[model samples]
Target: MDIRLNQLTMQFEEMTAVDRMTTTINNGELVSLLGPSGCGKSTTLMLLSGLYKPTSGEIFFGDKNVTRLDAEKRKIGMVFQNYALYPHLSVLKNIMFPLRMQKVPKKEARERAIEMAALVRIDHLLKRKPAQLSGGQQQRVAIARALVKKPKLLLLDEPLSNLDARLRLEMREEIRRIQQEVGITAVFVTHDQEEALSISDRVMLMNAGSIQQDSTPQQMYKKPVNEFVASFLGNPPINLMTVERMEARQYKLENSAQMVLLPERLNHERVRVGVRPEDLYLTDKDSGLLSGKVLHIETIGRDTMIRLKIGNTSVRALVDPKHQLQTGDICTLGADRDNIHYFDCDTGERVNVEKEAQGDADTADVEEYA
Candidate 1:
């Protein structure tokens, strides 16, 4: 089912949690509401699930207005950060609880519960109580319980936050698989950027109770609308450097004396350059963009994070673990033109000369083709 929020707003006594937010979620799409804590992601989920009435505006689930609908009437299957399983109920009973409440026959409910339990790969633990099961097992049971109802929309609020690192990874894949198999519209709330980017069909990045950017994971990561989206989406984050355009198509570090000539297209007087850690390569002093001393090195098996000081700025570069470099070692780092991102330092908006030129060329080509 497709979901649409039209001017949805939620306000506390003195503060607004959701500020006139509006967005559309396509049918069977796994959309994630991602932001920092208290960013209104959870509030938006609750509004969609019909747990809280919006202060104003409307919510439509596939053309049917559900803004004022009650939670049970909306047919939303919700799983929260806490498992919320009943202590006295066995896994089978917990899975069956929702069905039984809906007045489904005992035999039919048991059959559906069994089917869901097996779907989540927890059928063997049907008789185990919540206390008897591991964290991951309990989580699976919670999911099975939510799915057994076969709700039109599934709402997950940090469903994997309680699991350990290994379990979190395992459960993330499981959740993705199950969502795909069921073909249900789902809205997932998470503070973890990797989690949101990894599984979501599209991500809605929120900030200060407003939607900052809503797009596919790859678009949000690669072509972020602004620096906030860029810095928020990547691991180790994008390296942002303040630079000033110098004479002869050259740019100089604002704080440092190092100067390098860039492509003629990048003649902006002042700009912020963003480069991913992986985009930077360590090279010899003569071949590098700027020379710096390594301040720290963190080796994580397959990749190493090298922290280097360039003039007054600190930068991180992710290089192959095989490249042996130690602290206090002098290294030069450089990135290709395509890997470099130029942004307006004052506005934080991306500045793409190539894209603009390509767009103009495409328009001219279309006119000629016509």
Candidate 2:
């Protein structure tokens, strides 16, 4: 179930929903298409499922060209955001619908349906209708129905979006377990960054009808290709600062006397620095790189987020919950040299600054715990 999209473009009227998207989804690997709303993730899913023919380029499922294949003929199972279950049909009948459509014997279809239902943990609810099940149960039914067909490729478009916060977490884990058990290649579409990072082996981030970056979740977060990818992947969002390169390893912070030092000199004179909220550590004002006043403090369970105003710029830092910091407290924030990221100011591309005499940059400096 390896899929390759070669320059796949889907255009509707004057708008191009997907633009020259090319990527490979390896066999038995679950990859998530992650992006904001209207970023073409869902449209890409539609193209892959054969609901929309590509305006240009080709799609290959392994060695077979499936660009012109019909939706029903592609052997692709799709689970929509709304679940799209038949309210009038019983759970068993719904799960067996695909097999029934393929002219399988009633007894065989029933047996296979029962197995799939159990795999998704919905076997006991088979006698009930869609209306009788809860949201989570209904979603399980949808998954069972899609998987009962034993599809080679499974497409899930925000399957957990309709569930509650807790239910969404539970269902996502169940989906991952079922996908692993079936060993099917899955393409999941989701706008939630956490959900995408938590379940998928890799993530394809899309924006404005174009593919932003495709990489393993860890690589996508740790070594982002651009500002958009970095900003989109984080929960509290990566802190961005516009700064000027003073000399070799020195960068003058905007509207402040604070300075940032990297291991090596950047190729660009003007750059933007990116630091994650968790990377900014609170220290003594005299020892920190930047001094700021705490504007607000929020304690959300285990982590405390402190909003600070530094050098005419506002930044948020994640601190230990036990830290005795208040709103009026003056705090100094410092970022580890390896944790700081620099991008070309104009182009918004990451500037790979090499360590002096080292020839190349080292990523091992910052531990990739997150």
Candidate 3:
């Protein structure tokens, strides 16, 4: 089932939670409503599930307008973050509870419950109560209960938030696999960027009750629409340096004499340079543009986060963990000119800079900041 929100707006007493949001979710696509807290992602989910009627706007399940439809009548299955399961009921009974409420015959309900339990890999725990199961297992049961009804749409609200890191990873994959196997339209709400980027067919990044960017995970990371989207998507986050125009294609880092070569077409007197931590490469101190003293180092598996000080500014770079570097060691980092995102200093919008042909491109026309 495809979902559509047209001019969707939800207002509180004095504030708007969702502001004129318009988007289309295709059939069988598992899209994620992703953003930090108070971004209206949850409100939009409630609206999609028919729990909260929009203040103004229309919603369609395929082609049928159901903006004012009640939650119970939406034909949608939902999973909550808390794993709201019945302690008094066994796993099988919990999975069958939804059908039982609809007056499904006991035999048929039992069969369907068993089928869903197996689908979620919780069939072996059918006789256990909610309290007797692990966090991941209980979550599986909750998912089984939600799916047993075979609703046309499935909505998950931070469904893996309550689990441990490993369990969250495991359950997310399970959810993706099950969603594909059932061929149901799914909307997963999550504040975790990794969670949203990993399983979603496409991500709808939200902020201040508005859509920032609705695109594939790769696009959201590589080509963010604006400054916020660019800064918000990465792990260590993109390194942003405020540079002032020096002369022609030259720019100087703030409060320093470091010079950078921007695209020849860039005419902005002031722009922010955005480069991902991973895009930074270690180079000889005298040859690199941004050389500094290492301030901190954090190792995670095969990757290490190196924090360095360039003049009065702090910069982060993701480098190979095997490249030995101590806190006080001098380090220098350089990045491809084409990899940097130039943003307008005044509006925080991306400023396009045309790159030179491959044969004429210059990657290291820079000098370290004093």
Highest-lDDT candidate: 3
**Candidate 2: where is the Cα deviation over 4 Å?**
285-287, 354-370
Better of 1 and 3 by TM-score: 3
**Better structure of 1 and 3 per lDDT:** 3
lDDT for model 2 comes to: 0.87
TM for candidate 3 is: 0.92
Ranking by lDDT: 3, 2, 1
Q: What tens digits encode model 2's per-residue C-alpha lDDT throughout 311-336?
A: 78889899987779889898888888
Model 1 lDDT per residue over 270-300, tens place: 8888889988998776667767889999986
Stretches of candidate 3 above 4 Å error?
284-289, 321-329, 354-370
Per-residue lDDT tens digits for candidate 3, residues 1-370, read 6888999999999989999999999999999999989999999999999999999999999889999889888889999999999999999999999999999999999999999999999999999999999999999999999889999899999999999999999999999999999999999999999999889888899999999988777667766767988998888889999998889978888977677767778798889889999999898765465888899999977789999987888999999887889999988888876678888888887777655323212213211100
Alpha carbon deviation, residue 323, candidate 1 (Å): 4.0
Best by TM-score: 2
Q: Report the alpha-carbon TM-score of model 1 versus the true structure.
A: 0.90
lDDT of each: 0.87, 0.87, 0.88
What lDDT is obtained when candidate 1 is compared to the true structure? 0.87
Error of 3 at 32 (Å): 1.0
> Per-prediction count of colliding residue pairs?
0, 0, 0
